[model samples]
Target: MRGIDVEVAPGEVFGFLGPNGAGKSSTMRMIACVSPRSEGTLQVLGMDPGVDGPRIRARIGVVPQQDNLDAELTVRQNLEIYGRYFGLSRAHVRAKAVELLEFAQLTERADDAVEPLSGGMKRRLTIARALVNDPELLLLDEPTTGLDPQARHLLWERLYRLKREGVTQIITTHYMDEAEQLCDRLVVMDGGVIVAEGSPAGLIERYSTREVLELRFTPESAPTAADLAHLAERVEQLPDRLLLYAADGEHVHREVARAGHRPLTALVRRSSLEDVFLRLTGRSLAE
Candidate 1:
């Protein structure tokens, strides 16, 4: 991955999106002050990370891609122990632990051992633990990677609540929907550089047509990309299907039918961040 430029305003949710090893994690680590940058200027909260690492880190909350909860401790104890590292008074830590547990919807599990919690629960606890110090900025890396749909949505809701309460956030995720849901602005990273930067809608508007028509055919019945060249602004050929990018999906659908190409299946949908990434990178965002 390459070093990239980004500026996130206060109280905003900024998303960093890319495939595995696209440098998203590298960027996040730099921002989190866990890994030193090899070159270029890096600033968090108007302070230089190199000189003020501890001070900058004290004001930031981090939820890593993987949960690192202490399995030997109960939920509340984990938070209590983490707070001690930050030098919070014992009384303050106790109060904060209870408050955070309630905020994370884990009050009932406060006494339960972390080893017995589900993945989502443990993730929530990790997030809660990060908040013990009342950070001004939160960093979440691939926050929803392995969760079920319901769990993902629940986490999204929790994050949205934080955003509403004026907590600035920087997130790195591979899920297009996660970017669309949580990001006020985002930069699409590929090969260690930013390929595109804008709000979800802005990127979609700039990189893709207004709509997309997905056509699938039998393995033996596929049409050449050239066969649909004039049907839309752009035509992307894939092994199993063809994506026609056009202003009007239905219009392109009809054009494909009139061309004597019978597709096995067809669907029309609005453009999305996934379309923008694919258009710019020439590769699926996740793959």
Candidate 2:
């Protein structure tokens, strides 16, 4: 992927979406002031990152891709140690830890050691720890990568609440549904650059038809691209299926059936960001 260029408005949840090794983490690090950009202009909160790294960092909350919480300390102690690094007063740190524990739904486990926490619990604690200073902007990199479905939903609810409270968030994830549910706008980065950028709906509208018709057949009997020609505005052949992009999926399905070539299976559905990414990059969003 190429280096991306986009702006994230305050009080909005902006998602950075791409596959592994797509430079998503690289971009996040630069914005977090942990890694400096080699070229191009970069700014955060209207301040030049190169000139005011410390000041920019002070106002941002970062939940890195990896869990870096101190395993030797209890959940509450971890928050206290992080708060101390920000030069917060002892009284303030203690109060903030309690509030964060509650916010993370970890008040019951406040005194529990980090080593004993489940993956989901650890992730939530890490998020709470990041908020100890009440940052103006929050950055999350693949926040739910290793989480189960229930845990993912819980985290999403917490993030939604934060958004309602007017927190500006920058999230990076390979999960299509997560981006659709959480991002107000996003940029699709591939290689080292941005291939597409818009709201999830806008990207789908611009890159793909309103609906898609998927036709599956046995590998040996699959219809060739030429066979499905004229059935849709565009036809894409996949390993085991043919995608027909059209204005009306049901109508396209009828057309396909009328042609006397019966697919083993077929379905019509509304277009999604996954379709948009596949159309633009010629690969799945998670690939």
Candidate 3:
């Protein structure tokens, strides 16, 4: 993660947005104190990670990209065991486990074995386990990568509650919608470097137009960018479509039809963080 600099404010949800191997995970590991930084200075919670790894870890929580619950244990036991690692009393951990089960909405599955639970339940358990110490800062790495839509929404609600209680979050994700919905401020990274940094609305306004008009044409009959050049401020021709970057999508679409460049389908929508990413990296976010 060379040439990368970041600062996260208290009680704010900060994000690292990029594709796979874009150094998002590497930066996250450094912040978590699980990996060492080879160069440059990094401080977390007003302490150097290398000098105070254990001290910093005790005051923070981490939710990894993958679920790593103990398969043989019951849902509630997982929380208890992790809490004891910090030298908390068994009685304290037991009560803490009860409270966390309720927090994660897993009170009914308290005794159920971990392996048979659904993906979302396990993820919630992992998060609940991380909060046993009630850390001040929370680190999440791709918190909702593989879950279904319903599961993703549920998790988002849980995270929102945490934010209301003033837990600072540092999240790494490749999902554009997730960053837009969750991050108060974020940085766009590609090739081990940060390309852009701002709020979602600010980034869109700075790097992209207010609206985009997407026209899909078949490969055999695809029109060149110049054919629609005069319709908008800029034109981008893709493998299956042409993007007209304009402030007013409705008017641009009307002008496109007037120019006799009919496409198979046309879609007019607001510009998104994906558009900003495409403008910076010359590739889709999914790439």
Q: Model 3, 1-287: lDDT tens per residue?
A: 78888898889999999878789988999999999888999889999999999999999999988888888899989999999988889999999999999999999999999998988888989999989999889999999988899988988988889999999999998788999989999999988999999999999999999999999987877789998898898899887789999999999999988877778999999999989977886675544
What is the alpha-carbon lDDT for the whole of candidate 2?
Answer: 0.90
lDDT of 3 at 267: 95
lDDT of 2 at 172: 97
Query: What's the distance in Å from true for residue 249, model 3?
Result: 0.4
What is the Cα-based lDDT of residue 2 in candidate 1? 62
Backbone clash total, candidate 1: 2
Among all candidates shown, the one with the greatest lDDT: 1
Q: Which wins on TM-score, candidate 1 or candidate 2?
A: 1
| Per-residue lDDT over 1-287 for candidate 1, one digit per residue giving the tens place of the 0 to 100 score | 46588999999999998778788998999999989988899999999999999999999999999999999999999999999999899999999999999988899999999998988889889889989999899999999889888888889999999999899999999899999999999999888999999999999999998999999998787998898998899998988899999999999999899989899999999998988876766675445
lDDT of candidate 2 over 83-172, digit per residue (tens): 999999999999999989988999999999999899999999999988988888999999999999998999999999999988999999
RMSD of each: 1.6, 1.8, 1.6
Candidate 2 regions with alpha-carbon error over 4 angstroms: 1-3, 219-221, 284-287
Instruction: State the C-alpha lDDT per candidate.
Output: 0.91, 0.90, 0.91
The superposed Cα distance between candidate 2 and the true structure at residue 165, in angstroms, equals 1.2
